[model samples]
Structures are given as structure tokens and as C-alpha cells.
Target: MRADAVSRAVLEQLRELHCLEPEQTVCCALSGGADSVCLLRCLLELRPVLGITITAVHVNHHLRGAESERDRTFCQQLCAGLGVRLAVYDVNPAARAAQEHCSEELAARECRYAAFAQVQADWIATAHTASDNLETAVHRLVRGASLHGLTAIPPKNGRFLRPLLRVTRRQVEQYLESLGQTYVTDSTNLTDAYTRNRIRHQVIPALEQLNPSVERTVSYTLRSLRREDDFLHQQAQAAYAKCHTGKNTLSGLETLHEALQFRCIAMLLEEAGISCEAPLLERLAALARQGGRWNLSGAVYAVGKSGTLTIETVQLPEPLPEAIPLQMGENRLFSGFVLHARLETVSPAENVANIHKKFANACLDYDKIKGEIFLRPRQSGDRMQLSGRGFTSALKKLIQANLPPERRRTAHVLADADGVIFAEGVGCAARVCPDGETRRLLVLEILGKC
Candidate 1:
């Protein structure tokens, strides 16, 4: 019942969160620090009363020399003594940073969260105290953020929980002191080399001079902001549903409030696997209203037309298929389609309307062929005169009209030595159309992957 008791704080948080059910499993992320060690112990103390199982996980980010190993050892020993099952994972943050082309801090965070996801538990808890929230607020504010960013960490994000969010760092250390427990101190935390450490040691203490309970004050303010963010997010979700008229399209976004419009646009971008900044969101909003196109990162394009917006991700052209000789059997092309050619002799007096009707675009006049034929992808400047069409059009145009942006790169082109005989979805060219003069017919069909 003491104010400094972390177990009471965790219990109160669980009661309010409703994230746990009877006999559910809870896993604590044991970082071997005072905060993490204190959290693991408090959950152990509360396990019986809460009717839940307790487990611990340790992620050894091999950043520091021997200190990292020391932390891991401490965690193993601590979990063993507490009689709690533990899972340990080792990750190379430096290697991950180099591979991902990002900072070590971000790489380390990714490594830690990925490790947390592997732990088998109904809820995964981390020891982020009120003090950490204050530091996070300062960090996000310095980096330029909106209401959501300023709100910093939430108490519960999906299966992850921050039970110590309402508790202070001072209480964490005091609770450990109450039990005479010792924890490993990471040397990196004492220095200001990292941005988070700089904010924690410098900016936080500076603000503490004005308000001794600045951490508590920031936590209270952030709690209120989080509630507001949740409300806006719910409203935005409803508006997004109403605006979504079809797949990859959103309509009537211009009719909503500017805030709702932005949120709706955000939902659209998010569904397309795009993470945007404010400027990008603003540009998309403008596109949604005025009708235009914005080139997004990674060959993606956001297009707006007739009050509807959509995203198109341009695909890298598949390797041009090696010209394979078209024969009287099936030829499987690397372009993910099979070209089957069946040869048949036809007399001028033969009634072939049924054959042409059944295989309209798949038949070719074999006598019109000048030389051998091959199956391949469309070439630049390639032109095809489709059957029944009077004029020839660029193969590129036909592909653009018939296939999606992603599939156009892999569109098949069937041709003879003279010119293109047939195109995928465009049918046999006018030069190869079967008629009464046709002496032989080459029935061609393109089948999809088996």
C-alpha cells in the first residue's frame, strides 16, 4: 500500500488496463537494470493474487565489451533465483545497424522488440517509468512532433505493456532498496553519448529545477493527450471506412473536416505500406482535393482523379525472356506464362467460323508467317495491329491499358520474324488473323503459372 511500492502500482495498472485475464501468462523484459529487475520482482510478488504465470526474457545486445555479458549473467542468475522461466536471445546491434543503414540506437530497439515478440506470453511488459516518458517527450519535441508524438509511450501497445509507466525512477530504486537487491548498471547509461541519455541526464534535471515533480507532471499531461489521441483515431477510422469506396481508392475525402481528411489520408497511405511525414500527408491531402499525382518513395505513386485517390507501386521489369523458339508444343517462358502452339492444316473451303469464334484471339493464320516465331516480352517501339482494329498502336499503350502497373512489366509478346503476330490480352495481330484464304492455323494460347 506504500506509494513507493511498485507491485501496488502494477496491480492498479492491470485493473485499469483490463488487458489480462485469469491465468494468463505475463513475460517481463529483463534488461538487468534497476527498472527491469524491479519490475520482474514486483510481478513475481503479485503473480498469485493476479492468477497469472510469470516468465522473463533477456536480450543481450552485444554492444559493450564485457559489460553486456555481465548484464546477461545477472539476468540469468536473477531469474534462476526467482524460480521464473527465462528466454535469452543475443543480437548484434552493430551488424544490424550496418545492414539496415541506420543508427545503433534504432537498430538496438528493433533487436529488442523483435526479441520480445518471440517470448510466449499473453502480455509482454517493459520497464518504462514516468521518468522515461518525460525524457521521451523532450526527445520527440526536439525532433518536431504532433500530438501523437508528444504523447510518447502508451501504457499498452497491442500485447506490450508498460506497468511501471505511472511509477517514478526514484520508486524503482527505492523498491529494490527495500529488498536489498542489487542490479547491474550499464556504463552507457551514465554517459551523454546517446540522445536519450543526454535528454535523461541534462534536459530532465534542468527542468526539475523549475518543478521537482516534473516527471509526474509530464506523465499526467501525456495521459490526457493519449486519451485525446485515441478519440481522434477512432473517429478517423470511421471516416476512413465511409470514404473508402473501392480497393485502392478513397472517395469523398474532400467532404470531411481537414483533421478527419488528414487522418483518412493517413489510413489510405498506411494501407499501402507507406509511412509519411506531415509534408507528405499534406501533399496527399492536396492531391485528394485537386486531383493530381505525387511520386512516393520506392517507385510508389499516389494518384487522384475524379475525387478518388489510389496508390500504384511500379514493379521492376522482369528479365526479358530469352527468345524461345515457338514450336507445336508448350513453351514455358520465364515470364510466368506458358505459350502453347497447336498446328493444324485448313482448306479454303473449310467452315472455320466455330474455330475462330471459340479461339478468337488465340488463333493465328499460319500461312501469313514469313519465317520462324518466338515468344518474348514486348520490346521498345514494338507496335501491334490488334485483330479487328484498323490501326496499329504502340505495344506500351496496349500494355498500359490492359495490364496493371505491376503486371505490365512482364506482359508477353508473341511474334514472328516479320513483326508481332499476337500480344497478351491484345490478341493475334491483324496480319495473322485467320480468314477464308488461310491454309493453315496456328492456335496459340497463353496459360498462367501452374
Candidate 2:
């Protein structure tokens, strides 16, 4: 926050990167941390001279319970006090990591980048200092880096810009101190629980003894590595273009250098939404050169024949579960959620219409449903008249209109011998809706992940 004079170095870096164009807007990724606060304030102070607008964005991972809320509230108050537009994104990195089968750290980074992608601005600024750059490089080195992963953090990547790449974390603290700015500290950072925290707490300090300005030195080395990596990437792109014949087909991959071949394979897998280990990559590269079949990630397989390679994803049919009786108490359905069913003694004096509207997708008239009720995935030609909608609509049409595309495959319908009575996403059928005369109610509530 000790901006203006202190921000000259950052301004020069931005100018070199051509990031702060006149009249353009820059959205700062603020986390209510010292580094991010300094970056936001610095950008705000430099806004007038650079002829740019400054805004902020924050993503709350919600992993720290009360601390998460504290960070979010601090970001909001800080943005309001500075009169800057702020955008906030709530992300559950743990859930995303589980779904993607990746580490929570990687998931959080992906979520942050995704949030950055949503901003309607010329540039998205992140508060990554030289210290962070060193830590990232070390962490990647410890794990193993195949390509540009070892190059650590870049000053600019697409629309994302790290203005303080050259600035050290100590300098950030000094800047904020001079301006009397306060920032929140994440409690997790104080512990060495995570791999990154361990590296930051133990490994970096050891290296600092070797060179007092180790962060700066490491940063310079990483910059050079980044340029070399970028050059190789361009070569790989050109090589892929020449070898790529058509969809899922490649020819003359053996002609390219091994590095280019591996890089090309990596690019292809990424495009196909597949991730594999280095050993599998080596095997796949060999398969691409020679003619053979090799099992790849998930249901995907690499097939090479007649001096050509192709990726074939064997999509085994995901058969729906057999229709089951809608029993009382808890029922786990094919939709990966629990449906709690129970009978309640609802009086005629109760606001039946209000109850129907409130739990439209859940409740149904037990008396109206003839025979035993069964739950199954939506079938073709199934139609139902939804309560209050006043029209009979096809189940597929109703699902298309009401449910998100991802949820459509898991949508279920409750049916009896007569017809459909309720849809998972859509409301209950009008014939099964409780009226003012109804004395009992069959309440169905969806308990996700239960």
C-alpha cells in the first residue's frame, strides 16, 4: 500500500509486459493477504498514472471454516473502503478434487484460474512475488517436472499477470507497513502440514543461507528456463501440425524428436481430457511410433496400426439401476442422492397450496398414486402434467427446461401403475398434488450425498 513511489518497479514490469494499456481495466486477484493487498493498493495508486481502472476478485475455498469467512469479509470491507468493484467466487476445492481425482491444491489453483477467466477485463493481476516463484519451482522440482512445470510461476500467462514477480514478499510487507495497511493471515500458512508449506518453511530458508538474495537469483534462472520451454512448446506445436493427420489420427510421430513426440502426445491427451503418468506417456509415445494397442487413462485406449495412431475411448454403457419400490424412510437412488420419504398428518386448515409450491419437486399425494410407487430413470415417451403448470409436457422436454445439462442423465421419475407422479428435477404431477381437502401428505426430500 506504500504505493506510488514503491510501485515504480511494478509499473515498469507491467509496462514491459504491455499489461496496463491506457483506458484498459485490470482486475486484481485479492485474497485479503499482505501480498495481494499490496498489489491491489499499488495498482490502485498507479491507476491514475497508467490510465487504467482497478478492480478486485476473490475466491473463498471455505476449507478453513471461520477463517474462510474472515478472509471473505475482510476482502469485501477492504474493497468497499477503497471504492473498488469486487467479484467473489465460492469454490469447494475438496469436492472438485474428488470429482477430478486430483490434489486439492491443484483443484484450488484450477478454481482460481477459472474464476479469473470469468472476469470481463483486459488483464487479471495476481499477487505472486519472487518468494512464491522460488517456492513453486522448488516444489515442482521435488515432485518432478516434465516440461514448463519446472519453470515455476510466470509474470504473464494469457490474460493473467503477476505484477510483483520481481518483488520479494519482504518488500510487500514493507510496502504495506509504510502505508499502515492491515491484512489478514491464513492460519494454515503458519503450519507445515501441506507440501508447499513444508517447502516454504524448511527448504527455502536453507537455500537463503547460500545466497541472501536467493529468490532473485532463482527467479532469473526460472525466467531463462521459461523462454527455453516456450521455444520448445512452439516447436512441438509445429511438429504436431505436421504429424497430425486427422481426428484421433497421427502419422510420422516417429520422425519427430523424442521430446517433441512426448510433448505432442501430452498436448493430444490434454485436448482429449485425459491425464496420464510419465511412464504411461512413454508407453503411449512408443505406441504412437510403432503399431500396437495400449490401455490408457479410464476407458480411453491408444490404438496404433498401419503407421498411424488414434485415441479410442470405449464408452461402456452406464446402465441405470433397476426400478425399485419407493419405500418409506431413506431410499438411495441411482442419482447418488438419498430420498427421504415419510407420511405426515397434514390438516385441511394448513396452507396446502403453499406447501405444494414450497416442496413442489418433492411432495406427492399418497392417495392419488395408485399401487406401489417405483423410482427409475426417465424413459422415452413419458409425459406428465406438472402441478400448477396446467399443461402436460414430455418428460424429456421438462428435464431439458428445468434441469442443468449435467444433471439430466441422473434425473429420475417416480411412477405408479397409472402413470408418472413426480420428476426428480421437475415438480410433481398435478394428479398427485395435495389439495386443501388432503389430510395426509407424503413428503419426499432429496438429501444430496447422504
What lDDT does candidate 1 reach at residue 98?
A: 98
> Candidate 2's error at 172, in angstroms?
1.1
Cα lDDT over the full model 2: 0.85
lDDT of 2 by residue, 1-450 (tens): 344545987887798886566999999999999999999999988888899989899999988899999999999999999999999999889999999999988999998788778888999999999899999999888898866898988889888899998889988888898889999999889999898899989999999999998988988898889889999999999988987788876788878888888888887888788886689788887786577998776688899775567899888758877888988898877656888888877766788767767666588777878898998889888999876677888999999998899778778778999888988878788998888777777888877754
**Model 1: worst 10 consecutive residues (lDDT sum):** 315-324
lDDT of each: 0.86, 0.85
Residue pairs whose backbone atoms clash in candidate 1: none
- After TM-score superposition, what is the CA distance of residue 277 in candidate 2 from its true location, in Å? 3.0
Candidate 1 TM-score, C-alpha based? 0.66
- Where model 2 places Cα greater than 4 Å from the true spot, the runs are 1-6, 60-73, 87-120, 288-291, 297-300, 303-308, 312-450
- Model 2 RMSD in Å is 19.2
Candidate 1 root-mean-square deviation in Å? 10.8
**What stretches of model 1 exceed 4 Å from their correct place?**
1-4, 297-300, 304-308, 312-450
lDDT value, residue 244 of candidate 1: 88
